[model samples]
Target: MLWRATDRRSANPLRTGLRWLLSLAFGYAGYRHLATPAPFLAITPPWVPEPALVVAATGIAEICGAIGLLVPATRTIAGGALALYALCVWPANFYHAFAHVTVGSTTLGWGYHAPRLAAQPLIVWWALWASGAVDWPFRTKARDG
Candidate 1:
């Protein structure tokens, strides 16, 4: 089981709002991936054995994770899963940065890629925080039993 805050009673407005916003973003991105996978395929690492299948699977997972986040019953599981998913797919981000891959006309450079690479942890934290999987500032360390 993934780490989660013990205090489920406390639900902050800001966190909830951010979570919803992210969900919308993910949902849209997922839809785009399903509708037009060419851009995603462009970012796929050359080493990947089957880029098309991977892209489709990742897109489906993202959509599911986004949907899971909205439901209170499955929020924690969804959060943990999404965090793991982000970690798993980070290689693509790294490849994009290192290779300076371009989708259509715009090429991704250090300015865009560096921050994206650096913000991965932040993305994981955001997923956890927004899903109420891990509370911070208000609560950091998990409660000791």
Candidate 2:
């Protein structure tokens, strides 16, 4: 069956809101990644091959996924892709935190790093929920069992 924002029994305001918000966030981040990749490059793990190419590819992926999230036909796949994308980039986040990556003479403290690391899972969840891929903590039991 084709998935849509209203695929559930009723419309979910929270899901709609998160979908738009995440789309905007990813779209902007994608633009920034393409426009200036220096910061991203700084945090990239040494093991990654062709950091520049990967950064550019990620930018394209982000932009495409962000656009896909809004289209009913592609929303589910987009959400899944984005969730995986977020997971894939986590190593860079860890590198940034532990390596004390400096971008433009500014090294983010643990205060910033900690919350960002913590938010990764939430981001993954948001994409899934917003795209109607899975609903948890909000799904009502049938007849209260």
Candidate 3:
């Protein structure tokens, strides 16, 4: 099989730890987005419509996804959703990087942006892996018939 479902009984400690870490990270970020939207609003791409509403909605999504990750019934869907969320927000990262969008008076240099941009894919993969949506590079080959 190309992908293996995660078994809670055999769950990897590293993966579980990372999953909890991601949940905390996303949850906190969601709270920040809701409580103080100015930074997010500042980074929003100019072409996006209703930036404020979009920011608010994304915050809710992050919070929901974070919560979903903690529930076994919702983990897979949460992983997929969070992965897609990371992909969806990529453009904003780009805009921030290329346009030099400043959050408050702090203008982030490429040093910060480079790693973040590169890490985006890792984040998506992390969500998928952590939530058991996919198991790759670690899945064993099936026995021959």
Candidate 4:
């Protein structure tokens, strides 16, 4: 809590590598959900209209963000987009946790989905920071005494 330099470096290579791996995996999963009617349907709340279209858009966003992270010029945008994408699907994750969204007769518990979903923003931020998309905001400032 006293130094701003704690976050002075860009993401380490191993961590950055992991970020890309996670991004690729997540993007693929999103694409799968978009491709299959059953998975897409499972997440759509009754209140939502045009569930298929929404799923497709989400899938596209995931793909774009995953690709964006690979390009330095687009890394920041990708991170931001990924974060936004995570927020967009939050309701679906919540619904699943509460059993409001059922994938077949199986519903995923919060324990399974929440940590990764909830950690997404931090992940995005870490990726962007690691990719050197921007300066770390307050490593020293926060620790200033």
Model number with the top TM-score: 2
Go through the candidates in order and give each one's C-alpha lDDT.
0.82, 0.88, 0.89, 0.66
Put down candidate 4 lDDT per residue, 11-117, tens digits, no spaces: 45664675678578667967786677687778676667788888777778777877877765566667667766777777776666666566777767767777856
RMSD of 2: 2.2
**What lDDT does candidate 3 reach at residue 75?**
85
For model 4, give the 10-residue run with minimal summed lDDT. 1-10
Better of 1 and 4 by TM-score: 1
What TM-score does candidate 4 reach? 0.71
The residue pairs found clashing in candidate 2 are none
lDDT of 3 by residue, 21-83 (tens): 999999998999999999999999999999999999999999999999888778888999999
TM-score for candidate 1, residues paired by index = 0.87
- Which run of 10 residues does model 3 get worst, by summed lDDT? 1-10
In candidate 4 the C-alpha lDDT for residue 13 amounts to 68
| TM-score of each predicted structure versus truth | 0.87, 0.92, 0.91, 0.71
lDDT of 2 by residue, 44-85 (tens): 999999999999999999999999998877888899999999
Indicate the worst ten consecutive residues by lDDT in candidate 2: 1-10
Clashes by residue pair, model 1 = none
Q: What is the C-alpha RMSD of each candidate to the true structure, in Å?
A: 3.2, 2.2, 2.7, 5.5
Put the candidates in TM-score order, highest first: 2, 3, 1, 4
Better of 2 and 4 by lDDT: 2
